[model samples]
Target: MRLDKFLKVSRLIKRRTLAKEVADQGRITINGTVAKASSILKEGDELAIQFGTKVVTVKVESLKETAKKEEANNLYSVVKEERVTAE
Candidate 1:
Protein backbone atom coordinates (compact mmCIF):
# COMPACT_ATOMS: atom_id res chain seq x y z
CA MET A 1 0.00 0.00 0.00
CA ARG A 2 1.11 3.57 -0.63
CA LEU A 3 2.44 5.35 2.41
CA ASP A 4 -0.17 8.09 2.30
CA LYS A 5 -3.03 5.66 1.82
CA PHE A 6 -1.70 3.40 4.53
CA LEU A 7 -1.49 6.33 6.89
CA LYS A 8 -5.09 7.31 6.21
CA VAL A 9 -6.46 3.77 6.11
CA SER A 10 -4.73 3.05 9.38
CA ARG A 11 -6.14 6.25 10.85
CA LEU A 12 -2.75 7.64 11.59
CA ILE A 13 -3.07 11.01 9.89
CA LYS A 14 -6.87 11.09 9.50
CA ARG A 15 -6.69 12.22 5.85
CA ARG A 16 -4.82 11.07 2.77
CA THR A 17 -4.06 14.61 1.58
CA LEU A 18 -2.62 15.57 4.93
CA ALA A 19 -0.51 12.47 4.94
CA LYS A 20 0.74 13.25 1.45
CA GLU A 21 1.62 16.78 2.42
CA VAL A 22 3.42 15.56 5.49
CA ALA A 23 5.35 13.04 3.46
CA ASP A 24 6.21 15.60 0.82
CA GLN A 25 7.56 17.94 3.43
CA GLY A 26 9.91 15.23 4.73
CA ARG A 27 8.05 14.85 7.97
CA ILE A 28 7.58 11.13 7.44
CA THR A 29 10.37 8.60 7.56
CA ILE A 30 10.51 4.93 6.83
CA ASN A 31 13.27 2.92 8.42
CA GLY A 32 14.98 6.13 9.44
CA THR A 33 15.02 7.55 5.91
CA VAL A 34 12.77 10.23 4.50
CA ALA A 35 9.92 8.72 2.54
CA LYS A 36 7.48 10.04 -0.03
CA ALA A 37 3.73 9.65 -0.31
CA SER A 38 4.09 7.00 -2.99
CA SER A 39 6.50 4.93 -0.97
CA ILE A 40 5.46 1.33 -0.58
CA LEU A 41 4.48 0.26 2.91
CA LYS A 42 5.09 -3.28 4.03
CA GLU A 43 4.66 -5.31 7.16
CA GLY A 44 7.25 -4.78 9.89
CA ASP A 45 8.46 -1.48 8.42
CA GLU A 46 9.10 1.25 10.93
CA LEU A 47 7.47 4.63 10.40
CA ALA A 48 8.35 7.77 12.24
CA ILE A 49 6.10 10.77 11.89
CA GLN A 50 6.74 14.23 13.16
CA PHE A 51 3.74 16.18 14.33
CA GLY A 52 4.86 19.59 15.51
CA THR A 53 7.03 18.96 18.56
CA LYS A 54 5.74 15.44 19.08
CA VAL A 55 7.17 12.40 17.41
CA VAL A 56 5.29 9.19 16.82
CA THR A 57 6.86 5.92 15.81
CA VAL A 58 4.94 2.85 14.73
CA LYS A 59 5.60 -0.45 13.12
CA VAL A 60 3.41 -1.56 10.30
CA GLU A 61 1.47 -4.62 11.31
CA SER A 62 -0.84 -5.02 8.36
CA LEU A 63 -1.94 -3.30 5.17
CA LYS A 64 -5.48 -3.08 4.00
CA GLU A 65 -7.35 -1.07 1.41
CA THR A 66 -10.00 -0.22 3.94
CA ALA A 67 -10.53 -0.69 7.62
CA LYS A 68 -13.35 0.01 10.04
CA LYS A 69 -12.75 2.45 12.85
CA GLU A 70 -12.66 -0.35 15.39
CA GLU A 71 -9.96 -2.14 13.41
CA ALA A 72 -7.78 0.85 12.57
CA ASN A 73 -5.47 0.54 15.51
CA ASN A 74 -4.71 -3.04 14.55
CA LEU A 75 -2.91 -1.87 11.44
CA TYR A 76 0.09 -0.55 13.30
CA SER A 77 1.69 -0.78 16.72
CA VAL A 78 3.05 2.25 18.50
CA VAL A 79 6.71 1.72 19.22
CA LYS A 80 7.57 5.08 20.63
CA GLU A 81 5.81 8.39 21.18
CA GLU A 82 7.51 11.34 22.81
CA ARG A 83 7.45 15.07 22.88
CA VAL A 84 10.62 16.95 21.99
CA THR A 85 12.15 18.22 25.15
CA ALA A 86 13.18 21.84 25.26
CA GLU A 87 16.83 22.41 25.83
Candidate 2:
Protein backbone atom coordinates (compact mmCIF):
# COMPACT_ATOMS: atom_id res chain seq x y z
CA MET A 1 0.00 0.00 0.00
CA ARG A 2 1.03 3.59 -0.53
CA LEU A 3 2.31 5.37 2.58
CA ASP A 4 -0.34 8.11 2.39
CA LYS A 5 -3.15 5.65 1.91
CA PHE A 6 -1.82 3.46 4.69
CA LEU A 7 -1.78 6.40 7.07
CA LYS A 8 -5.36 7.32 6.28
CA VAL A 9 -6.65 3.76 6.18
CA SER A 10 -4.98 3.12 9.50
CA ARG A 11 -6.65 6.25 10.90
CA LEU A 12 -3.30 7.80 11.79
CA ILE A 13 -3.59 11.01 9.78
CA LYS A 14 -7.39 11.16 9.32
CA ARG A 15 -7.22 12.23 5.66
CA ARG A 16 -5.38 11.02 2.59
CA THR A 17 -4.63 14.50 1.24
CA LEU A 18 -3.20 15.62 4.56
CA ALA A 19 -1.10 12.52 4.66
CA LYS A 20 0.13 13.16 1.15
CA GLU A 21 1.03 16.74 2.01
CA VAL A 22 2.84 15.62 5.10
CA ALA A 23 4.79 13.03 3.18
CA ASP A 24 5.63 15.47 0.43
CA GLN A 25 6.91 17.97 2.98
CA GLY A 26 9.23 15.32 4.43
CA ARG A 27 7.39 14.89 7.68
CA ILE A 28 7.07 11.20 7.10
CA THR A 29 9.91 8.69 7.25
CA ILE A 30 10.12 5.01 6.49
CA ASN A 31 12.85 2.96 8.06
CA GLY A 32 14.53 6.18 9.13
CA THR A 33 14.62 7.69 5.64
CA VAL A 34 12.28 10.43 4.47
CA ALA A 35 9.49 9.04 2.35
CA LYS A 36 7.24 10.49 -0.31
CA ALA A 37 3.50 10.03 -0.63
CA SER A 38 3.94 7.23 -3.12
CA SER A 39 6.36 5.31 -0.92
CA ILE A 40 5.42 1.69 -0.72
CA LEU A 41 4.43 0.44 2.72
CA LYS A 42 5.00 -3.10 3.79
CA GLU A 43 4.43 -5.16 6.89
CA GLY A 44 7.08 -4.77 9.58
CA ASP A 45 8.38 -1.49 8.18
CA GLU A 46 8.97 1.29 10.64
CA LEU A 47 7.34 4.64 10.12
CA ALA A 48 8.17 7.85 11.89
CA ILE A 49 5.86 10.81 11.49
CA GLN A 50 6.43 14.32 12.68
CA PHE A 51 3.38 16.32 13.71
CA GLY A 52 4.46 19.78 14.74
CA THR A 53 6.74 19.15 17.73
CA LYS A 54 5.54 15.65 18.30
CA VAL A 55 7.03 12.56 16.71
CA VAL A 56 5.32 9.23 16.45
CA THR A 57 7.05 5.99 15.52
CA VAL A 58 5.18 2.88 14.58
CA LYS A 59 5.70 -0.44 12.93
CA VAL A 60 3.45 -1.52 10.13
CA GLU A 61 1.53 -4.56 11.25
CA SER A 62 -0.79 -5.10 8.34
CA LEU A 63 -1.97 -3.52 5.11
CA LYS A 64 -5.51 -3.40 3.91
CA GLU A 65 -7.35 -1.48 1.24
CA THR A 66 -10.18 -0.74 3.66
CA ALA A 67 -10.81 -1.34 7.30
CA LYS A 68 -13.46 -0.49 9.86
CA LYS A 69 -12.71 2.05 12.55
CA GLU A 70 -12.52 -0.62 15.19
CA GLU A 71 -9.88 -2.50 13.23
CA ALA A 72 -7.69 0.44 12.36
CA ASN A 73 -5.31 -0.06 15.24
CA ASN A 74 -4.45 -3.48 13.95
CA LEU A 75 -2.67 -1.89 11.05
CA TYR A 76 0.25 -0.54 13.04
CA SER A 77 1.88 -0.71 16.43
CA VAL A 78 3.14 2.41 18.15
CA VAL A 79 6.78 2.03 19.09
CA LYS A 80 7.49 5.48 20.40
CA GLU A 81 5.77 8.86 20.77
CA GLU A 82 7.43 11.95 22.14
CA ARG A 83 7.02 15.67 21.97
CA VAL A 84 10.11 17.72 21.16
CA THR A 85 10.98 20.13 23.90
CA ALA A 86 12.14 23.56 22.85
CA GLU A 87 15.50 24.38 24.26
Candidate 3:
Protein backbone atom coordinates (compact mmCIF):
# COMPACT_ATOMS: atom_id res chain seq x y z
CA MET A 1 0.00 0.00 0.00
CA ARG A 2 1.01 3.61 -0.36
CA LEU A 3 2.78 5.23 2.58
CA ASP A 4 0.30 8.06 2.88
CA LYS A 5 -2.67 5.71 2.75
CA PHE A 6 -1.19 3.43 5.33
CA LEU A 7 -0.44 6.32 7.62
CA LYS A 8 -4.04 7.47 7.57
CA VAL A 9 -5.68 4.05 7.57
CA SER A 10 -3.51 3.07 10.50
CA ARG A 11 -4.35 6.26 12.32
CA LEU A 12 -0.70 7.24 12.54
CA ILE A 13 -1.61 10.60 11.05
CA LYS A 14 -4.91 12.43 11.30
CA ARG A 15 -5.37 12.58 7.54
CA ARG A 16 -3.90 11.27 4.30
CA THR A 17 -3.13 14.77 3.00
CA LEU A 18 -1.15 15.59 6.14
CA ALA A 19 0.76 12.37 5.83
CA LYS A 20 1.55 13.12 2.19
CA GLU A 21 2.81 16.58 3.12
CA VAL A 22 4.96 15.18 5.85
CA ALA A 23 6.42 12.57 3.56
CA ASP A 24 7.02 15.09 0.80
CA GLN A 25 8.91 17.30 3.23
CA GLY A 26 11.24 14.38 4.01
CA ARG A 27 10.09 13.92 7.57
CA ILE A 28 9.47 10.22 7.04
CA THR A 29 11.74 7.32 6.31
CA ILE A 30 11.31 3.67 5.49
CA ASN A 31 13.96 1.19 6.44
CA GLY A 32 16.37 4.05 7.25
CA THR A 33 15.93 5.65 3.83
CA VAL A 34 13.87 8.73 3.15
CA ALA A 35 10.51 7.89 1.55
CA LYS A 36 8.00 9.77 -0.52
CA ALA A 37 4.25 9.94 -0.11
CA SER A 38 3.82 7.32 -2.81
CA SER A 39 6.38 4.98 -1.34
CA ILE A 40 5.35 1.37 -1.39
CA LEU A 41 5.02 -0.27 2.01
CA LYS A 42 4.94 -3.91 2.92
CA GLU A 43 4.61 -5.96 6.04
CA GLY A 44 7.58 -5.88 8.40
CA ASP A 45 8.84 -2.57 7.00
CA GLU A 46 10.03 -0.06 9.55
CA LEU A 47 8.90 3.51 9.47
CA ALA A 48 10.47 6.43 11.26
CA ILE A 49 8.44 9.58 11.40
CA GLN A 50 9.68 12.94 12.59
CA PHE A 51 6.90 14.80 14.30
CA GLY A 52 7.96 18.22 15.49
CA THR A 53 10.11 17.63 18.57
CA LYS A 54 9.47 13.92 18.77
CA VAL A 55 10.30 10.99 16.56
CA VAL A 56 8.15 7.91 16.33
CA THR A 57 9.21 4.59 14.93
CA VAL A 58 6.91 1.74 14.02
CA LYS A 59 7.02 -1.53 12.20
CA VAL A 60 4.37 -2.38 9.70
CA GLU A 61 2.48 -5.46 10.80
CA SER A 62 -0.35 -5.52 8.32
CA LEU A 63 -2.09 -3.49 5.64
CA LYS A 64 -5.76 -2.70 5.50
CA GLU A 65 -7.71 -0.62 3.04
CA THR A 66 -9.77 0.74 5.90
CA ALA A 67 -9.68 0.23 9.63
CA LYS A 68 -11.90 1.14 12.48
CA LYS A 69 -10.61 2.98 15.53
CA GLU A 70 -10.01 -0.24 17.40
CA GLU A 71 -8.41 -1.94 14.40
CA ALA A 72 -5.97 0.84 13.54
CA ASN A 73 -3.44 -0.15 16.15
CA ASN A 74 -3.17 -3.58 14.59
CA LEU A 75 -1.66 -2.13 11.44
CA TYR A 76 1.69 -1.26 12.99
CA SER A 77 3.72 -1.83 16.11
CA VAL A 78 5.40 1.00 17.91
CA VAL A 79 9.11 0.27 18.11
CA LYS A 80 10.31 3.49 19.71
CA GLU A 81 9.34 7.00 20.59
CA GLU A 82 11.79 9.71 21.59
CA ARG A 83 11.73 13.43 22.00
CA VAL A 84 14.40 15.45 20.18
CA THR A 85 16.18 18.14 22.09
CA ALA A 86 17.19 21.06 19.95
CA GLU A 87 20.85 21.98 20.20
Candidate 4:
Protein backbone atom coordinates (compact mmCIF):
# COMPACT_ATOMS: atom_id res chain seq x y z
CA MET A 1 0.00 0.00 0.00
CA ARG A 2 1.03 3.56 -0.57
CA LEU A 3 2.12 5.58 2.44
CA ASP A 4 -0.62 8.16 2.02
CA LYS A 5 -3.32 5.55 1.62
CA PHE A 6 -2.00 3.60 4.57
CA LEU A 7 -2.09 6.73 6.70
CA LYS A 8 -5.70 7.46 5.83
CA VAL A 9 -6.89 3.86 6.06
CA SER A 10 -5.14 3.50 9.39
CA ARG A 11 -6.69 6.76 10.62
CA LEU A 12 -3.31 8.29 11.31
CA ILE A 13 -4.32 11.28 9.22
CA LYS A 14 -7.77 12.60 8.51
CA ARG A 15 -7.34 12.73 4.74
CA ARG A 16 -5.16 11.35 1.99
CA THR A 17 -4.33 14.80 0.63
CA LEU A 18 -2.99 15.90 3.98
CA ALA A 19 -0.96 12.75 4.24
CA LYS A 20 0.49 13.43 0.84
CA GLU A 21 1.26 17.01 1.76
CA VAL A 22 2.95 15.97 4.97
CA ALA A 23 5.00 13.36 3.20
CA ASP A 24 5.94 15.83 0.50
CA GLN A 25 7.10 18.28 3.12
CA GLY A 26 9.47 15.66 4.59
CA ARG A 27 7.57 15.33 7.81
CA ILE A 28 7.30 11.58 7.59
CA THR A 29 9.98 8.94 7.92
CA ILE A 30 10.21 5.22 7.39
CA ASN A 31 12.94 3.43 9.33
CA GLY A 32 14.70 6.73 9.93
CA THR A 33 14.77 7.65 6.26
CA VAL A 34 12.61 10.37 4.73
CA ALA A 35 9.72 9.02 2.71
CA LYS A 36 7.50 10.36 -0.01
CA ALA A 37 3.76 10.21 -0.49
CA SER A 38 4.08 7.43 -3.03
CA SER A 39 6.35 5.38 -0.82
CA ILE A 40 5.49 1.75 -0.53
CA LEU A 41 4.34 0.33 2.77
CA LYS A 42 4.79 -3.18 4.05
CA GLU A 43 3.97 -5.12 7.15
CA GLY A 44 6.18 -4.33 10.14
CA ASP A 45 7.31 -1.03 8.64
CA GLU A 46 7.61 1.74 11.18
CA LEU A 47 6.22 5.14 10.32
CA ALA A 48 7.07 8.29 12.20
CA ILE A 49 4.67 11.07 11.35
CA GLN A 50 5.04 14.64 12.48
CA PHE A 51 1.84 16.39 13.37
CA GLY A 52 2.50 19.87 14.65
CA THR A 53 3.92 19.33 18.14
CA LYS A 54 3.22 15.64 18.24
CA VAL A 55 5.20 12.84 16.66
CA VAL A 56 3.30 9.64 16.18
CA THR A 57 5.11 6.39 15.53
CA VAL A 58 3.31 3.30 14.36
CA LYS A 59 4.14 -0.07 12.93
CA VAL A 60 2.16 -1.31 10.01
CA GLU A 61 0.15 -4.37 10.95
CA SER A 62 -2.02 -4.95 7.96
CA LEU A 63 -3.22 -3.45 4.70
CA LYS A 64 -6.65 -3.37 3.14
CA GLU A 65 -8.48 -1.46 0.48
CA THR A 66 -11.04 -0.24 3.01
CA ALA A 67 -11.78 -0.76 6.66
CA LYS A 68 -14.67 -0.19 9.00
CA LYS A 69 -14.36 2.39 11.74
CA GLU A 70 -14.11 -0.34 14.31
CA GLU A 71 -11.38 -2.16 12.37
CA ALA A 72 -9.37 0.89 11.45
CA ASN A 73 -7.31 0.74 14.61
CA ASN A 74 -6.19 -2.75 13.79
CA LEU A 75 -4.35 -1.70 10.69
CA TYR A 76 -1.45 -0.18 12.61
CA SER A 77 -0.11 -0.44 16.10
CA VAL A 78 1.08 2.79 17.68
CA VAL A 79 4.58 2.16 18.99
CA LYS A 80 5.25 5.54 20.51
CA GLU A 81 3.83 9.05 20.65
CA GLU A 82 5.85 12.05 21.65
CA ARG A 83 5.00 15.69 22.04
CA VAL A 84 7.73 18.22 21.35
CA THR A 85 6.97 21.85 21.82
CA ALA A 86 9.20 24.82 21.11
CA GLU A 87 11.58 25.52 23.89
Candidate 5:
Protein backbone atom coordinates (compact mmCIF):
# COMPACT_ATOMS: atom_id res chain seq x y z
CA MET A 1 0.00 0.00 0.00
CA ARG A 2 1.16 3.54 -0.65
CA LEU A 3 1.80 5.79 2.31
CA ASP A 4 -0.74 8.37 1.30
CA LYS A 5 -3.36 5.80 0.41
CA PHE A 6 -2.84 3.93 3.65
CA LEU A 7 -3.10 7.10 5.66
CA LYS A 8 -6.39 7.98 4.06
CA VAL A 9 -7.87 4.49 3.97
CA SER A 10 -6.86 4.00 7.56
CA ARG A 11 -8.41 7.33 8.54
CA LEU A 12 -5.16 8.69 9.91
CA ILE A 13 -5.61 11.63 7.59
CA LYS A 14 -8.93 12.87 6.27
CA ARG A 15 -7.84 12.79 2.65
CA ARG A 16 -5.20 11.29 0.40
CA THR A 17 -4.16 14.62 -1.06
CA LEU A 18 -3.40 16.01 2.37
CA ALA A 19 -1.44 12.92 3.23
CA LYS A 20 0.61 13.31 0.08
CA GLU A 21 1.23 16.94 0.87
CA VAL A 22 2.37 16.07 4.35
CA ALA A 23 4.66 13.30 3.06
CA ASP A 24 6.07 15.55 0.37
CA GLN A 25 6.91 18.13 3.02
CA GLY A 26 8.91 15.48 4.87
CA ARG A 27 6.49 15.27 7.74
CA ILE A 28 6.36 11.50 7.65
CA THR A 29 8.83 8.67 8.17
CA ILE A 30 8.82 4.94 7.80
CA ASN A 31 10.84 2.85 10.18
CA GLY A 32 12.89 5.88 11.22
CA THR A 33 13.68 6.98 7.66
CA VAL A 34 11.88 9.80 5.92
CA ALA A 35 9.37 8.55 3.41
CA LYS A 36 7.62 9.97 0.38
CA ALA A 37 3.95 9.92 -0.46
CA SER A 38 4.48 6.90 -2.70
CA SER A 39 6.41 4.98 -0.10
CA ILE A 40 5.45 1.34 0.07
CA LEU A 41 3.88 0.02 3.24
CA LYS A 42 3.82 -3.53 4.53
CA GLU A 43 2.64 -5.33 7.59
CA GLY A 44 4.67 -4.52 10.70
CA ASP A 45 6.18 -1.37 9.22
CA GLU A 46 6.28 1.54 11.61
CA LEU A 47 5.17 5.01 10.62
CA ALA A 48 5.91 8.27 12.38
CA ILE A 49 3.77 11.21 11.31
CA GLN A 50 4.51 14.73 12.43
CA PHE A 51 1.27 16.60 12.93
CA GLY A 52 1.95 20.14 14.03
CA THR A 53 3.81 19.71 17.33
CA LYS A 54 2.87 16.13 17.87
CA VAL A 55 4.47 13.02 16.45
CA VAL A 56 2.24 10.03 16.09
CA THR A 57 3.77 6.60 15.66
CA VAL A 58 1.88 3.59 14.41
CA LYS A 59 2.60 0.10 13.19
CA VAL A 60 0.92 -1.22 10.08
CA GLU A 61 -1.37 -4.03 11.07
CA SER A 62 -3.50 -4.55 7.98
CA LEU A 63 -4.07 -3.12 4.52
CA LYS A 64 -7.40 -2.68 2.87
CA GLU A 65 -8.26 -0.95 -0.39
CA THR A 66 -11.29 0.51 1.34
CA ALA A 67 -12.60 0.27 4.84
CA LYS A 68 -15.52 1.57 6.81
CA LYS A 69 -14.97 4.20 9.47
CA GLU A 70 -15.29 1.63 12.20
CA GLU A 71 -12.69 -0.57 10.50
CA ALA A 72 -10.11 2.13 10.08
CA ASN A 73 -8.42 1.65 13.43
CA ASN A 74 -7.90 -2.01 12.62
CA LEU A 75 -5.53 -1.06 9.84
CA TYR A 76 -2.86 0.27 12.17
CA SER A 77 -1.81 0.06 15.77
CA VAL A 78 -0.74 3.27 17.45
CA VAL A 79 2.61 2.70 19.08
CA LYS A 80 2.99 6.11 20.64
CA GLU A 81 2.13 9.78 20.33
CA GLU A 82 4.33 12.56 21.68
CA ARG A 83 4.08 16.30 21.67
CA VAL A 84 7.32 18.05 20.72
CA THR A 85 7.90 21.15 22.71
CA ALA A 86 9.38 24.07 20.87
CA GLU A 87 12.54 25.47 22.34
Candidate 6:
Protein backbone atom coordinates (compact mmCIF):
# COMPACT_ATOMS: atom_id res chain seq x y z
CA MET A 1 0.00 0.00 0.00
CA ARG A 2 1.05 3.59 -0.55
CA LEU A 3 2.10 5.50 2.54
CA ASP A 4 -0.37 8.31 1.99
CA LYS A 5 -3.30 6.01 1.45
CA PHE A 6 -2.43 3.92 4.47
CA LEU A 7 -2.15 7.03 6.61
CA LYS A 8 -5.64 8.17 5.63
CA VAL A 9 -7.31 4.77 5.71
CA SER A 10 -5.71 4.18 9.07
CA ARG A 11 -7.04 7.54 10.24
CA LEU A 12 -3.60 8.84 11.08
CA ILE A 13 -3.73 12.13 9.20
CA LYS A 14 -7.47 12.58 8.51
CA ARG A 15 -7.01 13.02 4.75
CA ARG A 16 -4.89 11.61 1.95
CA THR A 17 -3.83 15.03 0.68
CA LEU A 18 -2.67 16.05 4.12
CA ALA A 19 -0.75 12.84 4.45
CA LYS A 20 0.88 13.39 1.09
CA GLU A 21 1.85 16.91 2.04
CA VAL A 22 3.29 15.74 5.29
CA ALA A 23 5.27 13.03 3.61
CA ASP A 24 6.51 15.38 0.95
CA GLN A 25 7.77 17.75 3.60
CA GLY A 26 9.89 14.95 5.07
CA ARG A 27 7.93 14.61 8.26
CA ILE A 28 7.60 10.88 7.86
CA THR A 29 10.13 8.05 7.97
CA ILE A 30 9.98 4.36 7.35
CA ASN A 31 12.37 2.02 9.10
CA GLY A 32 14.37 5.00 10.26
CA THR A 33 14.83 6.37 6.74
CA VAL A 34 13.09 9.37 5.24
CA ALA A 35 10.18 8.39 3.03
CA LYS A 36 8.20 10.08 0.31
CA ALA A 37 4.47 10.30 -0.33
CA SER A 38 4.57 7.56 -2.91
CA SER A 39 6.63 5.24 -0.72
CA ILE A 40 5.57 1.64 -0.69
CA LEU A 41 4.56 0.13 2.61
CA LYS A 42 4.24 -3.43 3.73
CA GLU A 43 3.19 -5.30 6.81
CA GLY A 44 5.41 -4.93 9.85
CA ASP A 45 6.99 -1.71 8.60
CA GLU A 46 7.55 0.89 11.29
CA LEU A 47 6.61 4.49 10.63
CA ALA A 48 7.54 7.60 12.54
CA ILE A 49 5.41 10.66 11.89
CA GLN A 50 6.15 14.13 13.05
CA PHE A 51 3.05 16.01 14.15
CA GLY A 52 3.51 19.43 15.70
CA THR A 53 5.69 18.95 18.76
CA LYS A 54 5.38 15.23 18.95
CA VAL A 55 6.41 12.14 17.05
CA VAL A 56 4.21 9.09 16.72
CA THR A 57 5.61 5.71 15.87
CA VAL A 58 3.35 3.01 14.54
CA LYS A 59 3.76 -0.47 13.21
CA VAL A 60 1.86 -1.47 10.13
CA GLU A 61 -0.38 -4.33 11.06
CA SER A 62 -2.50 -4.75 7.98
CA LEU A 63 -3.55 -3.11 4.72
CA LYS A 64 -6.92 -2.82 3.09
CA GLU A 65 -8.58 -0.77 0.38
CA THR A 66 -11.03 0.71 2.82
CA ALA A 67 -11.85 0.43 6.47
CA LYS A 68 -14.72 1.52 8.64
CA LYS A 69 -14.12 3.76 11.64
CA GLU A 70 -14.14 0.81 13.98
CA GLU A 71 -11.69 -1.15 11.86
CA ALA A 72 -9.27 1.66 11.09
CA ASN A 73 -7.40 1.39 14.35
CA ASN A 74 -6.62 -2.23 13.63
CA LEU A 75 -4.55 -1.33 10.59
CA TYR A 76 -1.66 0.06 12.61
CA SER A 77 -0.44 -0.35 16.14
CA VAL A 78 0.95 2.73 17.85
CA VAL A 79 4.33 1.78 19.22
CA LYS A 80 5.18 5.05 20.82
CA GLU A 81 4.12 8.67 21.16
CA GLU A 82 6.62 11.10 22.60
CA ARG A 83 6.88 14.83 22.75
CA VAL A 84 9.78 16.33 20.77
CA THR A 85 11.46 18.33 23.42
CA ALA A 86 13.59 21.10 21.97
CA GLU A 87 17.18 21.04 23.01
Best by lDDT: 3
Which segments of model 4 are wrong by more than 4 Å?
none
Over 16-81, each residue of candidate 2 has an lDDT whose tens digit, in order, gives 999999999998899989999999998999999999999999999999999999999999999999
The TM-score that candidate 3 achieves is: 0.97
Which digits, one per residue and each the tens of the lDDT, describe model 1 over residues 7-86? Answer: 99999999999999999999999999999999998899999999999999999999999999999999999999999875
Give the residue spans of candidate 5 off by over 4 A: none
Q: Model 4: per-residue lDDT, tens digit, 1-87?
A: 999998898788889999999999999999999999999999999999988999999999999989988999999899999998888
Q: Stretches of candidate 1 above 4 Å error?
A: 85-87
The runs of at least 3 residues in candidate 3 whose Cα sits more than 4 Å from the true structure, single-residue gaps closed, are none
Lowest lDDT sum, 10 consecutive residues, model 5, at 69-78
Number of colliding residue pairs in each model: 0, 0, 0, 0, 0, 0
lDDT by residue (1-87, candidate 5, tens digit) is 899999999999999999999999999999999999999999999999999999999999999999999999999999999999988
Weakest 10 consecutive residues of candidate 4 by summed lDDT: 5-14
lDDT of 5: 0.96
Instruction: Show pairs that collide, candidate 3.
Output: none
Report how far off residue 47 is in candidate 5 (Å). Answer: 0.2
Backbone-clash count (model 6): 0
* Rank ordering of all candidates by lDDT, starting from the highest: 3, 6, 5, 1, 2, 4
Q: Which stretches of candidate 6 lie over 4 Å from their true place?
A: none
Give a tens-digit lDDT track for model 3, residues 1-87: 999999999999999999999999999999999999999999999999999999999999999999999999999999999999998
Task: Give the winner by TM-score: 1 or 3.
Answer: 3
lDDT of 6 by residue, 11-83 (tens): 9999999999999999999999999999999999999999999999999999998999999999999999999
